[model samples]
Target chain A: MFKKTILLKDTSFSPEDKTRDVFTRCLDYLREKQLEQDIQVVRVADSGVYGQGLVMKVLPDATLYVNLKDEDVTRVIDAAAQNKTIEGLALKKAPKQIRIVLRNCGKIDPESLEEYIATGGYVGLKKALLELTPDKVIEEMKKAGLRGRGGAGYPTWMKWKFARQVVADQKFVICNADEGDPGAYMDRSVLEGDPHSVIEGLIIAAYAVGASKGYFYIRAEYPLAVERIQKAIDQANAAGLLGKNILGSAFSLDLEIRLGAGAFVCGEETALIASIEGRRGTPRPRPPYPSVKGLWDKPTVINNVETLSNVSFILLKGSEQFASIGTEKSKGTKVFAVTGKVKNSGLVEVPMGITLREIVYDIGGGTISGKAVKAVQTGGPSGGVIPVDALDTQVDYENLQKLGSIMGSGGMIVMDEEDCMVDIAKFYLGFCVDESCGKCAPCRIGGYQMLEVLKRVANGQAKLEDMTVLRRISQAMQKASLCGLGQTAANPVLSTMKYFESEYKQHIENKKCPAGKCSALSNYAIIQEKCKRCSLCQKNCPVEAIPGSREDGFTIVQEKCIKCGRCLEVCKFKAVSKT
Target chain B: MDKLTPEAIDRIFKQNRQQSANWIKVGMSTCGIAAGADEVYATLVEEIKKRNIQVTVKKCGCLGMCHAEPLVEVCVDGMPTVIYGRVNKEIAVKILDKHVNSKALLNDYIFDLETK
Candidate 1:
């Protein structure tokens, strides 16, 4: 067996990589000392930590040495050889990815009830059932300061407490697993990975609220998540962790699965309740809220999948420990589904108040195209774009809200220099318009008018006054919409307009798409200086847009050119220019 | 698989506190499956059984590094536990042949994370 494994990387900003240099030096020294056989040196791609120049991690020991100079290299090698840590050089990295909601994920076999239980899965429910009273469970939740992770960030304890205090014949609890955000899949992963944790949390919620029945409203699109959750529910029933007299306790809660017919609007609490009640999945105005009047007009509590997942974790690992992880207000970690232009797109669970710069740059490993990050879009279609300048701000409910984003279900899509803000706004606004339930006229008509105005703006057919019209529609939608869907649907348009006004102005005044993303506003042309007189563009155009011979140097027929971007794609000489 | 009471939960957790030795876990979540982790899992299981390898293969969930899907984490008796990312069927066989049986870590596929 190898005595030491030295993992080295030159994580410096300079052009030269010193990882190989250090590796050679360490290898030479080890060989000279006749200890090469005992130690193995390997160059690795990612060391999890970044920008800490010439980083070396001695594996098995995991002793990390950062900012290594030539002199410190020898000392680090010696320390690794002796299984010792050099004093000042070794940094005990506080773990970056804190797995709380995802604690059982990727570790235990999700299908195995035994595996989940072995990982201290339902102990939280056990604690809530046997030791703590309903009031005490609510108290513990209040102490934990946990909030709804389904974008709104409402206090979870408050929802449970309100549902608990209501004097109703029968109460209901619903787990909103109808996650429909375009790029977000955190809830699906949790449901698929550790369904027992969620089942336990939902059981705890049922017990705390004195509810006799519960439902898992999962989207039909997530067949795997549904299967895993169904399996987990079955396993829990067999183990007495779910259904009647759970774990031999007095609390008898029956759990069932409700499949969402792929409606994005059903993610809203009221719409989800309607879907569950076998009615049209549309939102009704809130006065009694879901806590007082929900599903069959019985007092009910609706918790998000991630929020319920956190419940079991918060209870299992004490409220105080959960409270200690994040910001003062937003306790515990929040999972974000980072996608789009990001190098490493995945679900990352991090403590609240962690900077967006750290999330995008450090955790995500920067943009995939290596382009300068233009802005990061958080909260999906219902959220807004955060300019690269504002990326340094900490991520929490309040902070993201202040940044004009709501942390909507933790879908963090990164945008680079090539992404046009106007186009992005139009794309998201279009999604909302398509998904609009039409129950409320404000969301239906207002979203359509706003999208039309955005379309005109993108096509360079709108005046600067259209911007005012867009803002007017946005304000009307936010104020008069029936539910959260209509209320926040204008967020993307408003946010992109707010942060990237100059890009929008360029389209209106200069009639130029700065990012060249709006094809209508920009036209492609073959540069005479760059063109190699090749008939490639002419041969590739479907409409036969180009009319000239290869020897005569072909040029695009402007009137015939359909702007299909085929010529640009077929051109290997980099001759095609979009202007 | 009897209905577990409070006592049984404690006993299971106590038993699991000490991790099982010589196991390979493949990420079998949707993201992993989309990237063909299921094939990797099947290959490992089939090959391990065929070769009569002592290592136990198990299916797990996504570890959040989506760019490197079909990830497999291997832990043997003496070697350091390492996660091999972007693994395919070939890599699965190679992992079994080199990493597990021979106890030598593979080159150019380790995606270790501590934190940023």
Candidate 2:
């Protein structure tokens, strides 16, 4: 029975939360007017704006007003009660996200073909099969300016054209759902949320490239995504939309699912095809690219899960419409799996040119612990650490690359003050070394050797010259590694060294981990002054490292301590300290 | 199942695509299931049936918010369609009881991403 709804939030980083003050005033005014029943004012955790004071959103109209003064609460209540705008005080919030690829994600029932069709899902497949020719489809793609969403920003139309032009007896269109990036899963969500759209895109790609067979090279890790895709394929086939002759056209295509053995290298297209063909999943040198000779030495077209999902939208709502949303170079929306240390860690699909500040703060709802975000890791291990100062740099293939980071599979991990840069670098480098295929020397040997050097550095056993060795091995891997895996293996280490060398220097020179994350170089102890003879730290110590009871103030046995910080957390009195 | 022609596709789309009156959609993606969305979905279905609420319970894909897995989108007639993130059975029951039946938007759960 409420006539109006107002969303209130104090988005400022200031100590005092003005949200309660604003909410109380609004309620008081409404109660004084005896109109409390007519209006509902709710305080929200996030209003999508950061560092802006007293954000108020009037619902039904969704009129947002930001930076409101204490005096303006009565004015806001009066304006809302009268159903009138507050004129200049009304906040015009420009939407920070665009949803071309994720259009049907939260909106429709993904499992229902009828719901998908209602939302204009397979109309692209219908149009492609009956009306548009292969060349025309590629032409439309070119006009749309669609690029590959699989980190490498290759023009999608050119890849299609190459596959289409190749006169081959058999051609294949593969959906690269092998999203193996550490923090990236935009592909999985799209496949799960809007499976039909990706399927529709795959169908169109099949027709465009004259491919009768297609495979979805999904990783075994994503069981739900696999299940949803299987259900969608079944649904599509049952509806006669995917069989021998789809939509009654001569261009017949059949699709199948292939599970990856959870190898990160398999995300690379050549490695993906090799895995699908029942060969060992490893990247081969690309001489005759996948567009010409791929998947059993036949012509093949491989598009990422996201690129294909955009296909159906492009076909249904013309190429120009799809082209209109994003920046000039990177057209359409890019879905980011925004994770780590951030408050709203999830998938965010924004226009290509939107700043990282907008993405991290406006869309992602800022850092989780209310700490200053140190750096944002993009493109997974293959990408680099972008410091907060450079957050305003437009996110695109070229811009990210210019900042020494590639948009590898859209994994954006935000790191706050607590996360050690050197530790993070070592983790990624170790992942690459672990996942290295060992077919090539640079990736296999270089990745391992570099990881060893990083381990030595983190463990406080390496000299300054060892950093040179790390650099040399990294350069060698970048220049000589067979595939993208070996080539970008050194990114994490190199980027961290570039941005946070002081932290690394502290580890190596001072023999100290600034964040106390590297356990080998750090020690745990109890400060005598702060200890209130509490037995809590003594009891909770897993190793029984604290050798005293409450009678005598507890002291940590340094040798017995694993530096786990168990005592530090267990101590109510500020007794335990790690150094 | 007839092979859909362009004309038939248009007709079927128009006839079938009207907005549903009320429903609960749980994100059934890998992340969501890992966060116990299956149990949530099953509980929602079972609870709605037991309560005899005239609303449909369905499963959808991840809405790209994997951090808050087990996302639930609720759209009831005369209520604003809002997505509730990090939903468990307790929150699901609250969503059904408060949001659906009582017509009140739950506090601290609605994720209003301005998706265009």
**Model 2 lDDT at residue B51:** 89
Provide the lowest-lDDT 10-residue window in model 2 chain A.
A42-51
Query: What fraction of the true interface does each of the listed models get right, in terms of native contacts kept?
Result: 0.75, 0.63
Off by over 4 Å in 2: A14-25
Instruction: Enumerate the candidates' DockQ scores in order.
Output: 0.70, 0.60
TM-score for every candidate vs. truth? 0.96, 0.96
- What is the C-alpha lDDT profile of model 1 across B1-116, one tens digit per residue? 68889988988888888887899999999999999998999999999999999999999987888888888999998788888888999999999999898777776687876422
lDDT of 2 by residue, A351-403 (tens): 89899988998888788899899999999989899988899999888999988
* Predicted complex 1: DockQ: 0.70
Weakest ten-residue segment in model 1 chain A by summed lDDT? A42-51
lDDT of 1 by residue, A163-282 (tens): 999999999999999998889999999998888889989999999999999999999999999999998888888888877788888989889999999999999998899999999999
